[model samples]
Target: MKNYLILAAGLAFAAPAATAQSTASATGAAAAPISAGQRKAAEELLAATDSEKNLSATIDRMLSAQLEQNPGMKAVEPEMRAYLTKYMSWPSMKEDMVQLYAREFTEKELRELTKFYQTPTGRKTITKMPELMAAGMEIGQKRMQEHLPELQQAIAEKLKSQPPGAVK
Candidate 1:
Protein backbone atom coordinates (compact mmCIF):
# COMPACT_ATOMS: atom_id res chain seq x y z
CA MET A 1 0.00 0.00 0.00
CA LYS A 2 2.83 2.37 0.80
CA ASN A 3 4.53 1.64 -2.49
CA TYR A 4 1.29 1.98 -4.35
CA LEU A 5 0.59 5.33 -2.70
CA ILE A 6 4.10 6.50 -3.53
CA LEU A 7 3.73 5.39 -7.12
CA ALA A 8 0.30 6.94 -7.33
CA ALA A 9 1.58 10.23 -5.93
CA GLY A 10 4.49 10.22 -8.30
CA LEU A 11 2.25 9.50 -11.24
CA ALA A 12 -0.38 11.97 -10.15
CA PHE A 13 2.06 14.86 -9.92
CA ALA A 14 4.31 13.80 -12.72
CA ALA A 15 4.15 16.26 -15.57
CA PRO A 16 4.81 14.59 -18.89
CA ALA A 17 7.11 17.51 -19.74
CA ALA A 18 10.74 16.47 -19.26
CA THR A 19 11.80 20.04 -18.59
CA ALA A 20 9.29 20.67 -15.83
CA GLN A 21 11.70 19.85 -13.01
CA SER A 22 14.47 22.01 -14.45
CA THR A 23 12.01 24.71 -15.34
CA ALA A 24 10.68 24.71 -11.79
CA SER A 25 14.06 24.94 -10.16
CA ALA A 26 15.42 27.52 -12.57
CA THR A 27 14.04 30.35 -10.50
CA GLY A 28 12.64 28.52 -7.47
CA ALA A 29 9.83 29.53 -5.17
CA ALA A 30 11.97 32.00 -3.15
CA ALA A 31 13.35 33.86 -6.13
CA ALA A 32 11.99 37.26 -7.00
CA PRO A 33 8.58 36.91 -8.63
CA ILE A 34 7.02 35.78 -11.86
CA SER A 35 5.71 38.21 -14.46
CA ALA A 36 2.97 37.97 -17.02
CA GLY A 37 5.50 37.44 -19.80
CA GLN A 38 7.10 34.57 -17.92
CA ARG A 39 3.72 32.98 -17.38
CA LYS A 40 3.07 33.27 -21.09
CA ALA A 41 6.45 31.73 -21.85
CA ALA A 42 5.69 28.81 -19.57
CA GLU A 43 2.43 28.32 -21.39
CA GLU A 44 4.26 28.39 -24.71
CA LEU A 45 6.79 25.88 -23.55
CA LEU A 46 4.02 23.62 -22.29
CA ALA A 47 2.24 23.93 -25.59
CA ALA A 48 5.39 23.08 -27.54
CA THR A 49 5.99 19.92 -25.53
CA ASP A 50 2.45 18.64 -26.09
CA SER A 51 2.97 16.41 -23.09
CA GLU A 52 -0.71 15.86 -22.45
CA LYS A 53 -1.50 14.71 -25.96
CA ASN A 54 1.50 12.39 -26.09
CA LEU A 55 0.84 10.98 -22.67
CA SER A 56 -2.80 10.38 -23.45
CA ALA A 57 -1.86 8.42 -26.54
CA THR A 58 0.76 6.44 -24.67
CA ILE A 59 -1.70 5.60 -21.91
CA ASP A 60 -4.33 4.55 -24.38
CA ARG A 61 -1.86 2.26 -26.08
CA MET A 62 -0.89 0.83 -22.72
CA LEU A 63 -4.51 0.12 -21.78
CA SER A 64 -5.19 -1.45 -25.13
CA ALA A 65 -2.17 -3.69 -24.84
CA GLN A 66 -3.12 -4.63 -21.32
CA LEU A 67 -6.60 -5.53 -22.41
CA GLU A 68 -5.27 -7.61 -25.28
CA GLN A 69 -3.00 -9.52 -22.94
CA ASN A 70 -5.65 -10.22 -20.28
CA PRO A 71 -9.20 -10.19 -21.42
CA GLY A 72 -10.31 -10.70 -17.82
CA MET A 73 -9.40 -7.10 -17.18
CA LYS A 74 -12.42 -6.16 -19.21
CA ALA A 75 -14.47 -6.77 -16.06
CA VAL A 76 -12.91 -3.67 -14.48
CA GLU A 77 -12.24 -1.65 -17.60
CA PRO A 78 -15.02 0.82 -17.02
CA GLU A 79 -13.88 1.56 -13.49
CA MET A 80 -10.31 1.93 -14.57
CA ARG A 81 -11.29 4.25 -17.38
CA ALA A 82 -13.33 6.36 -15.05
CA TYR A 83 -10.52 6.65 -12.55
CA LEU A 84 -7.97 7.66 -15.17
CA THR A 85 -10.32 10.04 -16.85
CA LYS A 86 -11.16 11.79 -13.62
CA TYR A 87 -7.65 12.08 -12.19
CA MET A 88 -5.20 11.78 -15.06
CA SER A 89 -7.02 13.58 -17.78
CA TRP A 90 -4.88 15.93 -19.80
CA PRO A 91 -6.78 19.01 -18.68
CA SER A 92 -6.37 18.15 -15.01
CA MET A 93 -2.66 17.46 -15.38
CA LYS A 94 -2.12 20.57 -17.45
CA GLU A 95 -3.89 22.81 -14.98
CA ASP A 96 -1.93 21.39 -12.08
CA MET A 97 1.29 21.73 -14.09
CA VAL A 98 0.66 25.35 -15.00
CA GLN A 99 0.13 26.16 -11.36
CA LEU A 100 3.32 24.33 -10.48
CA TYR A 101 5.27 26.31 -13.09
CA ALA A 102 3.83 29.58 -11.91
CA ARG A 103 4.88 28.75 -8.39
CA GLU A 104 8.39 27.62 -9.32
CA PHE A 105 9.83 29.93 -11.97
CA THR A 106 10.32 33.61 -12.48
CA GLU A 107 8.50 35.18 -15.38
CA LYS A 108 11.67 35.98 -17.34
CA GLU A 109 13.02 32.46 -17.06
CA LEU A 110 9.76 30.96 -18.23
CA ARG A 111 9.81 33.19 -21.33
CA GLU A 112 13.43 32.20 -22.10
CA LEU A 113 12.49 28.56 -21.59
CA THR A 114 9.67 28.93 -24.07
CA LYS A 115 12.09 30.29 -26.63
CA PHE A 116 14.52 27.45 -25.97
CA TYR A 117 11.82 24.84 -26.45
CA GLN A 118 10.87 26.42 -29.74
CA THR A 119 14.30 25.68 -31.28
CA PRO A 120 15.15 22.55 -33.29
CA THR A 121 17.20 21.09 -30.44
CA GLY A 122 14.34 21.60 -28.07
CA ARG A 123 11.96 19.83 -30.40
CA LYS A 124 14.36 16.92 -30.79
CA THR A 125 14.71 16.61 -27.03
CA ILE A 126 10.96 16.49 -26.63
CA THR A 127 10.58 13.76 -29.25
CA LYS A 128 13.32 11.53 -27.84
CA MET A 129 12.52 11.70 -24.15
CA PRO A 130 10.06 8.77 -23.98
CA GLU A 131 12.61 6.44 -25.59
CA LEU A 132 15.33 7.73 -23.29
CA MET A 133 13.26 7.14 -20.18
CA ALA A 134 12.20 3.70 -21.38
CA ALA A 135 15.81 2.70 -22.00
CA GLY A 136 16.82 4.00 -18.59
CA MET A 137 14.06 1.97 -16.94
CA GLU A 138 15.19 -1.14 -18.83
CA ILE A 139 18.69 -0.65 -17.53
CA GLY A 140 17.34 -0.32 -14.01
CA GLN A 141 15.30 -3.49 -14.45
CA LYS A 142 18.33 -5.43 -15.65
CA ARG A 143 20.37 -4.22 -12.70
CA MET A 144 17.61 -5.27 -10.32
CA GLN A 145 17.42 -8.69 -11.94
CA GLU A 146 21.15 -9.18 -11.43
CA HIS A 147 20.81 -8.52 -7.69
CA LEU A 148 17.33 -9.92 -7.05
CA PRO A 149 18.48 -13.34 -5.89
CA GLU A 150 20.84 -11.78 -3.38
CA LEU A 151 18.09 -9.50 -2.20
CA GLN A 152 15.70 -12.40 -1.79
CA GLN A 153 18.33 -14.35 0.15
CA ALA A 154 18.88 -11.42 2.46
CA ILE A 155 15.15 -11.17 3.06
CA ALA A 156 14.97 -14.88 3.82
CA GLU A 157 17.80 -14.55 6.32
CA LYS A 158 16.09 -11.61 7.99
CA LEU A 159 12.84 -13.50 8.23
CA LYS A 160 14.55 -16.55 9.67
CA SER A 161 16.29 -14.41 12.28
CA GLN A 162 13.12 -12.66 13.34
CA PRO A 163 11.12 -13.89 16.36
CA PRO A 164 7.85 -15.67 15.59
CA GLY A 165 5.85 -12.67 16.80
CA ALA A 166 7.99 -10.30 14.75
CA VAL A 167 7.55 -12.49 11.69
CA LYS A 168 3.86 -11.72 11.56
Candidate 2:
Protein backbone atom coordinates (compact mmCIF):
# COMPACT_ATOMS: atom_id res chain seq x y z
CA MET A 1 0.00 0.00 0.00
CA LYS A 2 2.65 2.45 1.02
CA ASN A 3 4.97 1.65 -1.85
CA TYR A 4 2.62 2.90 -4.56
CA LEU A 5 1.53 5.92 -2.59
CA ILE A 6 5.08 6.68 -1.54
CA LEU A 7 6.36 6.65 -5.09
CA ALA A 8 3.38 8.63 -6.38
CA ALA A 9 3.81 11.16 -3.62
CA GLY A 10 7.45 11.59 -4.50
CA LEU A 11 6.58 12.14 -8.14
CA ALA A 12 3.79 14.52 -7.24
CA PHE A 13 6.14 16.52 -5.03
CA ALA A 14 8.56 16.89 -7.92
CA ALA A 15 5.92 17.54 -10.59
CA PRO A 16 5.36 21.17 -9.65
CA ALA A 17 8.97 22.16 -10.28
CA ALA A 18 8.88 20.44 -13.65
CA THR A 19 5.61 22.10 -14.50
CA ALA A 20 6.85 25.48 -13.34
CA GLN A 21 9.96 25.13 -15.45
CA SER A 22 7.92 24.09 -18.47
CA THR A 23 5.35 26.80 -17.97
CA ALA A 24 7.67 29.62 -17.00
CA SER A 25 5.83 32.04 -19.26
CA ALA A 26 2.54 31.18 -17.56
CA THR A 27 1.16 32.58 -14.31
CA GLY A 28 3.51 31.41 -11.62
CA ALA A 29 2.61 30.64 -7.94
CA ALA A 30 2.25 34.38 -7.42
CA ALA A 31 -1.39 35.36 -7.72
CA ALA A 32 -1.51 36.28 -4.07
CA PRO A 33 -0.30 34.98 -0.76
CA ILE A 34 -2.68 32.54 0.90
CA SER A 35 -4.26 34.06 3.97
CA ALA A 36 -4.66 32.51 7.41
CA GLY A 37 -8.40 32.10 6.91
CA GLN A 38 -7.91 30.18 3.69
CA ARG A 39 -5.26 28.10 5.34
CA LYS A 40 -7.76 27.21 8.06
CA ALA A 41 -10.35 26.32 5.48
CA ALA A 42 -7.87 24.09 3.73
CA GLU A 43 -7.11 22.38 7.02
CA GLU A 44 -10.81 21.89 7.60
CA LEU A 45 -11.18 20.27 4.22
CA LEU A 46 -8.23 18.02 4.93
CA ALA A 47 -9.78 16.88 8.21
CA ALA A 48 -13.08 16.14 6.49
CA THR A 49 -11.31 14.04 3.90
CA ASP A 50 -9.48 11.90 6.46
CA SER A 51 -6.84 12.02 3.74
CA GLU A 52 -4.00 10.15 5.39
CA LYS A 53 -6.11 7.53 7.15
CA ASN A 54 -7.92 6.87 3.91
CA LEU A 55 -4.65 6.52 2.02
CA SER A 56 -3.36 4.06 4.60
CA ALA A 57 -6.55 1.99 4.34
CA THR A 58 -6.48 2.09 0.56
CA ILE A 59 -2.85 0.98 0.56
CA ASP A 60 -3.71 -1.87 2.90
CA ARG A 61 -6.48 -3.02 0.57
CA MET A 62 -4.28 -2.70 -2.51
CA LEU A 63 -1.46 -4.67 -0.90
CA SER A 64 -3.90 -7.36 0.22
CA ALA A 65 -5.25 -7.65 -3.29
CA GLN A 66 -1.76 -7.82 -4.72
CA LEU A 67 -0.68 -10.50 -2.26
CA GLU A 68 -3.75 -12.50 -3.12
CA GLN A 69 -2.83 -12.44 -6.79
CA ASN A 70 0.84 -13.15 -6.17
CA PRO A 71 1.42 -15.49 -3.27
CA GLY A 72 5.16 -15.11 -3.65
CA MET A 73 4.81 -11.52 -2.42
CA LYS A 74 4.32 -12.99 1.04
CA ALA A 75 8.04 -13.71 1.27
CA VAL A 76 8.89 -9.96 1.43
CA GLU A 77 5.57 -8.66 2.76
CA PRO A 78 6.85 -8.23 6.30
CA GLU A 79 9.78 -6.10 5.22
CA MET A 80 7.63 -3.97 2.91
CA ARG A 81 5.09 -3.47 5.65
CA ALA A 82 7.76 -2.39 8.09
CA TYR A 83 9.28 0.06 5.62
CA LEU A 84 5.97 1.76 4.88
CA THR A 85 5.05 1.96 8.53
CA LYS A 86 8.33 3.65 9.31
CA TYR A 87 8.67 5.95 6.33
CA MET A 88 5.11 6.66 5.17
CA SER A 89 3.37 6.85 8.49
CA TRP A 90 -0.05 8.48 8.59
CA PRO A 91 1.12 11.52 10.56
CA SER A 92 3.87 12.38 8.10
CA MET A 93 1.65 11.91 5.04
CA LYS A 94 -1.17 13.94 6.52
CA GLU A 95 1.15 16.83 7.26
CA ASP A 96 2.61 16.68 3.76
CA MET A 97 -0.82 16.63 2.08
CA VAL A 98 -2.11 19.53 4.15
CA GLN A 99 0.79 21.67 3.06
CA LEU A 100 0.29 20.64 -0.55
CA TYR A 101 -3.37 21.59 -0.42
CA ALA A 102 -2.70 24.91 1.25
CA ARG A 103 -0.08 25.79 -1.31
CA GLU A 104 -2.29 24.86 -4.25
CA PHE A 105 -5.63 26.41 -3.26
CA THR A 106 -6.70 29.84 -2.18
CA GLU A 107 -8.73 30.74 0.88
CA LYS A 108 -11.72 31.76 -1.18
CA GLU A 109 -11.69 28.43 -3.03
CA LEU A 110 -11.17 26.49 0.16
CA ARG A 111 -13.99 28.35 1.88
CA GLU A 112 -16.25 27.58 -1.03
CA LEU A 113 -15.25 23.96 -0.78
CA THR A 114 -16.05 23.91 2.91
CA LYS A 115 -19.50 25.23 2.17
CA PHE A 116 -20.12 22.90 -0.74
CA TYR A 117 -18.69 19.77 0.87
CA GLN A 118 -21.06 20.10 3.78
CA THR A 119 -23.98 19.58 1.40
CA PRO A 120 -25.42 16.11 0.66
CA THR A 121 -23.88 15.97 -2.79
CA GLY A 122 -20.60 17.07 -1.32
CA ARG A 123 -20.83 14.30 1.26
CA LYS A 124 -21.22 11.73 -1.49
CA THR A 125 -18.24 13.16 -3.32
CA ILE A 126 -16.23 12.98 -0.13
CA THR A 127 -17.22 9.39 0.43
CA LYS A 128 -16.26 8.40 -3.10
CA MET A 129 -13.04 10.41 -3.40
CA PRO A 130 -10.79 7.57 -2.22
CA GLU A 131 -12.37 5.15 -4.68
CA LEU A 132 -11.95 7.67 -7.46
CA MET A 133 -8.34 8.41 -6.55
CA ALA A 134 -7.54 4.70 -6.29
CA ALA A 135 -9.12 3.99 -9.66
CA GLY A 136 -7.25 6.88 -11.23
CA MET A 137 -4.00 5.65 -9.72
CA GLU A 138 -4.60 2.20 -11.19
CA ILE A 139 -5.23 3.72 -14.59
CA GLY A 140 -2.07 5.79 -14.36
CA GLN A 141 -0.08 2.71 -13.35
CA LYS A 142 -1.39 0.76 -16.33
CA ARG A 143 -0.60 3.59 -18.72
CA MET A 144 2.92 3.94 -17.34
CA GLN A 145 3.37 0.19 -17.59
CA GLU A 146 2.14 0.29 -21.19
CA HIS A 147 4.82 2.83 -22.10
CA LEU A 148 7.73 0.88 -20.63
CA PRO A 149 8.64 -1.06 -23.78
CA GLU A 150 8.76 2.08 -25.95
CA LEU A 151 10.67 3.93 -23.26
CA GLN A 152 13.16 1.08 -22.95
CA GLN A 153 13.58 0.92 -26.72
CA ALA A 154 14.10 4.65 -26.88
CA ILE A 155 16.78 4.45 -24.20
CA ALA A 156 18.55 1.60 -26.00
CA GLU A 157 18.47 3.50 -29.27
CA LYS A 158 19.87 6.61 -27.61
CA LEU A 159 22.67 4.56 -26.13
CA LYS A 160 23.47 2.99 -29.47
CA SER A 161 23.37 6.34 -31.29
CA GLN A 162 25.84 7.98 -28.92
CA PRO A 163 29.54 7.87 -29.78
CA PRO A 164 31.73 5.50 -27.72
CA GLY A 165 33.28 8.42 -25.82
CA ALA A 166 29.77 9.82 -25.09
CA VAL A 167 29.04 6.68 -23.09
CA LYS A 168 31.85 7.59 -20.72
The lDDT of each candidate is 0.68, 0.65
RMSD per model, one decimal: 5.1, 6.0
Error in Å for residue 33 of model 1: 9.3
- Cα RMSD for candidate 1? 5.1
Model 2 C-alpha lDDT versus the unseen true structure = 0.65
lDDT of 1 at 99: 57
lDDT, candidate 2, 1-168, per-residue tens: 554455435433332233433343255544445567766887898766655666577557656766786677788778766766665566646554555566667777777777787888888987887678668878999999999999999999999999988976
The Cα error of candidate 1 at residue 135, in Å, is: 2.2
Clashes of 1: 1
Which residue segments of model 2 deviate by more than 4 Å?
1-36, 69-79, 141-149
**Model 1, span 1-168: residue lDDT tens:** 343344345454344643665565665645445566766766776787776777676556555655676677777767766767777777766755665676666777676777777799988987887678668867989999999999999999999999888976
The candidate 2 region of ten consecutive residues with least summed lDDT is 13-22
TM-score of each: 0.71, 0.61
In candidate 2, clashing pairs total 1
